[model samples]
Target: MTIQSDRARDALLDAAEELFARNGIDAVSNRRIVEHAGAANHSAIAYHFGGREGLLRALVERHHDEMARRRRELTEQLGETPNIHELVTTRLRPLIELLDSLPKPSWRAQFMSQISAVPSAVEVAKEVIGDADLPDDLRFINGAVDGIPEGVLRGRAYLLGSMVVGVCADQEAKMNEDANKGSWEQVGRFLIDAAAGMLGAPVTDPDGAVRYPSVPLL
Candidate 1:
C-alpha cells in the first residue's frame, strides 16, 4: 500500500511485539495491538497480517531473522574453527545488540521472559525458529569449538540461549539499576570473555564451576 500504510503496519508490529512480550501470544488481541500502535485503521492488523497468528509468526520471523543474521555474520568472521570464546562471542553479540537497540528494552525482555516460562509461547518461538531454515553456519561455528564435550553441547546451547534470553529479560534493567555502563558492544565482549572458559576449541571449563550455562534439556 502507501508509505503511510506501511508505517502503520510497522506500528502494528511494534505494538504486537510489545503486547506479546508483556502478556504473551495468547493474551494479545488485534484491537489492543492496533490501539497500542496508534493506527487510525482498526483493520490494520488484519490488512497487513492475516490475523494474530500471522502477526505472531511475523514477529518471531523478524526477531529470529535478526538473531540468525548476526549469528551467521559472527560465524563467518570466526572462520570454520572458532574457539570457545569466539563461539560464545558469536552467539552473544546479536542478543545484546538487539536488547541495546530497543527503545523500550523492557518490552523485549518481558517477551523473552515469557518464551522460557510460558509453554505455548515457547512452542511458538521454537516453531518459528525451526522454520527459519537457518544455514548450517551455526553448526559449523559450533563444530569448530572442540573444547566443550559433545554431550554438553546441547546443554551449553540451552544455557547460552538462556543467558542471552536473560540479558533481554530484565537483565539490562537490572544491570542499569546496578549502574552498569557500556552498550551492546561492551556487554557482548564481557559475555565472550566470561563464557569462553566454559566452551571452546580445546575446552577450558566444561563443568562450569564458576558460572551457569543455560543450555536446554535434551
Candidate 2:
C-alpha cells in the first residue's frame, strides 16, 4: 500500500476503535468506520484492512506494540530483583496506559467485552498476551523470586499471569462506573499494591497454589 493508503487505513482503524468500543463490535459496520474516518469511499475498510476482523487485528497489533514498548521500559527500570511494587507496577502499567490513552474508553471497553465473551477472540487474546513481546519481564519476575523451586515458580507464574489479564481487563470492566473515584495513577497504584502483596511471592500452601484476593482491575 502507498503511504497515503497507510494513512487512510490508520484513520479507519481509529474510527473503528472508537465506534466498536462505544457500540459493540457486532454493532459497528464497515461502512460506519469508513464514514467516521471521513474517507470518500466506504469500501476503504475492505481496500485497506481486508475486513472488520482485519481492522480489529491491526488495532490490536498497534496496541500490542505500544504495550511491548512500555513493558521494555518498565523492565529496564526494574533491577535484577525488583521489589513487589516494581514487579506489580511494571506488569500493570501498560494495560492502564492502553486504556487511558484511548480516546474512547467506553467503546474500547465494549470491544474488549465482546472479545472477552467471544471464544474465538479469547484464544487469540490469550496467545497475544502469552506471546507478549517481552520475555525478559517474565524472566525478571521469575528471577525476583529465584528462591522458589522451578516447578513452584512455573505454577506461580501461571497463576500470576491469570491475575494480570484480569487486571488488564479492569478498565473495560469499569467502563460504566464513575472516574471521579480516582485518577489513572491511583488505579495503577492500587493494582500494584494488591498484586504485589498477593502474587509477587511464592505461595506457602500445601499445594503451593495461591489465590489473588482482589477483584478485577482494568
Candidate 3:
C-alpha cells in the first residue's frame, strides 16, 4: 500500500481501538469508526479490516505480539526452575510496561480487556494469538499448576486471565482520569502474588480430602 493508504488503514485501526475501548464493540458503528478516522470514505473499515470482528482481531494480534514477546524475554531470563511468582509476573509485566511506555493515555488496554471479557471476541483473539508464537511461560505456568485437577485448573486459568484484564482496565481508566504516575508497579506485584497463590493453592479431592502443595507458598 502507498503512504496515504497505509496511514488511512492505521487511522482506521486507531479510531476503532479508541471507540471500542470507550463505547464498547457492539455499540460502535462502521460509519462512526470511519468518521472518527477523519476519512472521507465511509467504507474505510470494511476496506481495511472487513468488519468489526476483523478490526478487533487485528488489534488483539498486535497486542498479543507485544505481550508474548515480553513473556518470552522474561522466561528466558530465568536461571531454571523459576518460582511461581516470577512465572506469574511474566503475565503482568508486559501490559504494565506497555502502559508505562505510552506517552498519552491509550485505550488499547481497555480495548483488550473488553474483548477478553466477551466470549465471541475472545474466540477471535484466541484465533489470532493461536497463529502467533506461543511463549515458553505458558509451559512453565502449566507445570506449576499441575497439582490442580484439570477442571479446577481451567477455572483458575479463566479467573486469572479475567482478573489481569480487569485490573489493567481499571488501572488504565485511572491513569486516563487522574494522570496517576508509577501506580502500576504496586498492582502488578499484587497480581503476581495473587496469581502465584491461586495457581499454587492446594487441591481438594472430590472425596472431601485436601492435598496441600509440597512446595511452600511465597
Kindly give the number of clashing pairs for every candidate.
Answer: 13, 6, 0
| lDDT string, candidate 2, 20-126, tens digits | 65666767778888889999997788788777666766765556667667877987887766775787687678977776776634445445555654455555555
Clashing pairs in 3: none
Pairs in clash, predicted candidate 2: 21-107, 21-108, 22-107, 170-217, 170-218, 171-218
In model 2, the runs with Cα more than 4 Å from the true position are 1-4, 104-110, 126-139, 146-181, 201-218
Best by TM-score: 3
Quality of model 3 by C-alpha lDDT: 0.71
Candidate 2 achieves a global lDDT of 0.62
Give model 3's TM-score versus the native structure: 0.83
Worst 10 residues of 2 by lDDT: 209-218
As for lDDT, the candidate ahead, 2 or 3, is 3
Work out candidate 3's RMSD over C-alphas: 5.7
Better candidate number, 1 or 2, judged by TM-score: 1
Across 1-218, the per-residue lDDT of candidate 3 in tens digits comes to 99989999888888888898998887888899899999998877788888778887787766566777887798788766777788777767887787767656678778876685466776776677652232333455666666655445445656677677787788888888886664777877788889889877887763443332111000
